[model samples]
Target: MLNIEKTFDQITAMGPVHLKIFTYIMQMLRDKYDVSMIDFDIEKSIFFYGIDSLKIIEIHSALEARLNCKIPTEAFFQANTFKGMIDDIVKSISNDGNLGIETSHYSLETEIQEALDYLLRDRPQRDEGYQTELTHTTLLTGASGFVGTFFLKELLENTDLKIFCLVRAADEAAGLERIRKTERKYNAHLPQGWEDRVQIVIGDMSKKRLGLTDEVYQEYAKTIDSVYHVAAVDNFYLPYNIIKKTNVVGTVEVADFALEGKIKPFYHVSSCAVSLLEQCSDPPTIIGLVNGYAQTKYVTEQIILRIAEKGLPWSSFRLGYLYTLGISDVDLDPNVSFKKLLQLVAKAYDKVEDDFFIEADAFENFLMAIPEIGCVPDLDANFDLMPVEYGAKAIIKTSLLPMSELKSCYTFYNPCPLDWSDIVNYFKQSNKRIEKVPLNTFVDKYAEYVRHTDDNSIKLLKSVVSSQLDQQLNTMFRQIDTDMVKEDIHWCPPCEKQFTHAYVDFVLND
Candidate 1:
């Protein structure tokens, strides 16, 4: 057996303030709970094994009460080891003696006065050195989507670049207003006077020449230095003809416009799914088995590659699923059969069909971890998942790349390596009764169940589940080869398990 005592002694000798705090914490637990180091499995306990739900709350409460530090729940997960946990707690306590809130409760008027004083003290000071260097006017397509929203906010926050957003309709003012609302909704900390820097240009991607009249096209062509093409038909169930019209042909139109105008660079948002669905003779890579969406993305990539060969200063970013702070409100796309299965399970449980049961929230959280959510043909597959904010930051960073780097048709960016297993474990932790069925067993049982049940929902659910299992298994065997550009991407800050519990409490009470 590994010498847990020796390892812990080494950690203690490190003399990091956090390690000292942890030592104190361990002593407290030993005294109060009679929790000996021997009773805890150093490797398997909360420290090394990852934070399960209950342990996260206990740690958070302990920190607040003992050290008077208000630590975020996400911190527990990020601090995967005991040493890391101690470091974070020590930093939090040292920075502010009070855990999270002020040390003492005060009158409402006094609190308001204190808040105003703090805000004023921290206000940004204008200096010539702080002035922005970005001078060129830029154009952004697909300014409505999640990535688009984050990109717009970042540009507004960091640079003085004048932005021209492409809208589908002639009501450019209304579109711009909507963009402002979205910015405020997501980035409440945005600097004042940010909206004044943006302008909107009405143009439809589907229209030939990007729906731009000759006069407007010529004017924008002369002025705009760069174009960020973030728009695409993200739905998988949509027909090839429709997808081709928007993703491929529309892209060509934008490229043509940029080429004619002599624009320095054009940034395109492409999905990692483009590498999917190739034959065994072709180079092996994990193809997301979602459906036509992946295939269409592949075709779209070919279009860009062809354009690149002809000498267009363009760069393509292949990204995985982009999630936002807001839970997806778009009902499960029709193509996600797993969603159908969930619906079926929900219905069957209403009739008390079996002793086994799974809650809707657990199923939804599980789906979020998987690649296929808003997209169709919900295949059980792993994907590089990144928060929308991180994805946008990467796109902006890539856009700033030199013309020489823009020569390639594709440049892969992998921002987050959120393992699907971690998500599965989270769901399992949330609900202990719903045992994890092996992917094969899940498919086999689902198929058998479908044959006996005439209900359309159940049939659809089984089909989706079986297909997803097959896809997931195939992905395990097949892997794609591409040069992935890794960057230090920010993830959603870890929150305490109490936060999730709080959400659950609110939902139950409501």
Candidate 2:
């Protein structure tokens, strides 16, 4: 016989206050959704049976209201089991206890705001009375990229800057429509009259001077304050000449344009790959790679630095592996390294070799043979793992820094210091039934599995699995350095228990 009281008692033993909050949530669900064990096993239905993701958001809001705690956004994925959810709620209580944030006295908004203030202690104070007039109308290349989209969101949230996006199409109306769609997709609730805050300019980075007409260039010069150059060809396997033309020469054009316009501060997005292959004498490695992508980025960085020296207040941001919700669509282009590896693995799997072990062996050899293999050093390398949102926040915050405070031509903001080992451990723990294998071994096995599975749908499944692994790995790595960013910015903490509970409930339902 199931002892409901005893189950509740076990939860209460973990923490009395958290138990109260859980009781409140359960009661609310029962009343609102008519959810009950008899009705459909509430836990199993919500967690394992695969409730809508939007419903999870609703639950998050409900729990916050009941507990008077600001559950971190990351907690949604972390607390995927029933017990795990309760444990997370208890942990929230513990953290709040230290802050003297009593649920009985303080409103949820007040508590959330206080937490935000503490997290963003190092951020520049907002000047409410300062004239909202943006002296510079900035154009963001790759305005559709993950970093670009988040950057736009961060700007909207934190600053009064006017943004213009460079679009590939020459037609102004078509570009504006595309920008609108992007805005609606990311954030539907645009500030009243937000369209007035943005403009879409037709330009192509591949062409000379961004292919802008003289009249358009003059108008840009007169109105734009600076340009955030984020567009680049990232195909690692592409010919050196092709990469050089787009990444290197294209950057030279952008720099020249910025210089010609006398834009006060030009921002360039470089990759951490630029800091590869070269052995550094210090405790941590800082030197970059010899590969085409890294080498081109290094050259671009030098060009931007030279531009800064020649009177333009230019800043180069060396970003690391970027992870976000829509990353599969934005970051993982078909030509990128990860996608290429997946394709290779998929093709190898299709051959139907005699033994899985043989297939795995071949895949392992292929991964190892890749050039410029460098491990992410110092589990806390700031740029090693960064969430798209946090990365955007860092970029916007740094951009807003006063000219006097901006000392370096190149500034490195490591978004998060998450450990890959933590991610590997997490996967191992999550799928305990699956035998733990070394990364190389796992990759081999995965490749072999893909090869042997005859179903056509397996290709999509493999892609999804790879993307999830990338996301989890990136999250773990960012967690290593999140303390600094958390201290300096408003980022939701990981709600490990809630996500775990959710996962458990989901599995049970399935």
lDDT of each: 0.51, 0.50
Error of 2 at 444 (Å): 5.0
Q: Would you estimate the TM-scores of all the predictions?
A: 0.53, 0.50
Model 1 lDDT tens row, 1-510: 445576476566866665656666676456654566664543343544444344444445555545543443334433446655565555555755333221111132332233233322322321212112225777888776546777776677656789888877558678876675555444323446756877778888767768989888877876676777787776432233335567766666676555544434667778765554433222222122433345456655655555556565666777665544332213333344443534532443354323322222322333432222211122344445344655666667656665566445543333223344444454456655545656656455444443443333232232235434445434522343433334423233122243233333322332
Best by TM-score: 1
- Candidate 2 lDDT (Cα, whole model)? 0.50
TM-score of candidate 2 versus the correct structure, residues matched by position: 0.50
Worst 10 residues of 1 by lDDT: 125-134
Residue-level lDDT of model 2, residues 29-103, one tens digit each, is: 677666663333324324563444445555655666555545432333344465565565566556443321111
What local lDDT does model 1 show for residue 377?
27
- Count of residue pairs whose backbone atoms collide, per candidate: 14, 43
